[model samples]
Target: MTDSPLHVTVKLNAKLQPEHRHELFEDPLDALLESAELGQLTGGGTALTDEGEVDYGDIEIALTDPASLPGVIELLEQLGAPKGSLIQRAGEPDQPFGVTEGLALYLNGTDLPDEVYEQCDSNYVFEQIVERIEGVGEICSWWQGPTETALYLYGVSFETLRERIADLVATYPLCQGARVVKIA
Candidate 1:
């Protein structure tokens, strides 16, 4: 099945002049598109000839996976976006998925030993995984519900994470039923 597209909207800071809006958001938007392997804006644009109607630094894109957001956020941070620059889902009321500090691996179904949890927590496991692959940011483990335990990681390349965790679960039977989740 095709993944549902997510609308990524970058709204400019008011301090930006209308004339500079396109230049400011253009590269970041392109970076988001390139990193996500996406094309085209979903909706909205500034008036070309009417400066009075022009809005500052707004760019929108439709991304294929919610997981792609972190890369875009990282790129925007690198681009030196203004303090009030906003990234959000186009039509949603809640904050955008990009706001999530990290990705989470939700492990449920198996009731592993407490010692296993202590030893294979996100930080320890992330350290092990990153030795084989280069990944940045923090990760740690914790319980989310009565039955659900999670391994949360800050920076992620989603596919890399899935493969790494699949390997981890292969060696550690305790995580056999883990499902990668994004916690925003």
Candidate 2:
């Protein structure tokens, strides 16, 4: 049997353009600062201080299994920004998988259109999962395939991941079916 991987969630606060708020992106500590600067100049938001930096607010990032980091980064780049970036704050763990306190599950599926896939980012999926699990304490885990295929999700025992998968499969008209798989 494989052992569960250790995971750590990081939080970052940044300054961004309020106007371009919808187009913001998520990044690590260093990237967040750079993105915030660029976002402020492009989005037209004012820097809270005279340092020419816009306050993009805070974001909480959950790193599940750590092995998924590369995939997560790809997802973020595709999506405009990180998930739950609009509401998350520092010093928060985004609740727990169950107990109605944190993000529930991670989602994976296929059959996504080129345009849709291009528009999607890790942050987008991450935020979607967070929204679904909010107050319910679950995580939604699923994946989108390139063609007509089943959405398979594994390693999601948290309520947040579970609910997220359920919601995405239900809400997204593109998906046909969703299923859960055991983590190897």
Candidate 3:
């Protein structure tokens, strides 16, 4: 059986102002699912349903190729215009550990072989992991900020991440000023 493309659902906080609320969808069907799923995930509305509760509160995107994830994430950031906080993860819910800030990249350690530190792309790494472990192996998610937006990705590759970062830097001048945190 063919596997389903990874599904990402982005939920915007209810407190955001109307002006900041905007919607961007790569596919119409995925957009519809995102709206429905986000509403369900966040619950109805705190006030009333008819009040037009935060129109841009949710977003969804489907990804098949892991290499395409970083680019997809860059697009989401551009469309949503994030203000704060970006996080990424690798693998499924119970077993996920690679996380990155600023760029919204994550890697799955469990999926990798003991010595496979570098790979062509995050997606390739995931694929390799899957081959060894019998699971799909690539998963990632991102959040724009408090009331900004959130996104999810699956089957992503490191080469994709590098390309995406380059694209982001070119497209968003602000990315040039981004700082990476290092631990000793």
Per candidate, the number of residue pairs that clash is: 0, 56, 11
lDDT, model 3, position 123? 46
lDDT of 2 by residue, 4-116 (tens): 43333321122234333324333233254344331111111233444333333333344324454444344443432323223222464452111111121223346455665
Model 1 over residues 1-184: C-alpha lDDT tens digits? 1377777777643223343444544655675577657655665454322324222346677777677667666666554443445676656653422322334666653476777666665555546655644454334223344466555453445455556556775776556567776432
Give the C-alpha miss distance for residue 146 in model 2, angstroms: 12
Candidates sorted by TM-score, best first = 1, 3, 2
Off by over 4 Å in 1: 14-19, 35-40, 47-55, 90-184
TM-score of model 2 vs. true structure = 0.26
How does each model score on lDDT? 0.53, 0.36, 0.33
The window of 10 residues in a row where model 3 has the poorest summed lDDT is: 39-48
For each candidate, what TM-score against the reference?
0.39, 0.26, 0.27
- Native-to-model Cα distance after best TM-score fit, residue 150 in candidate 1, in Å: 50
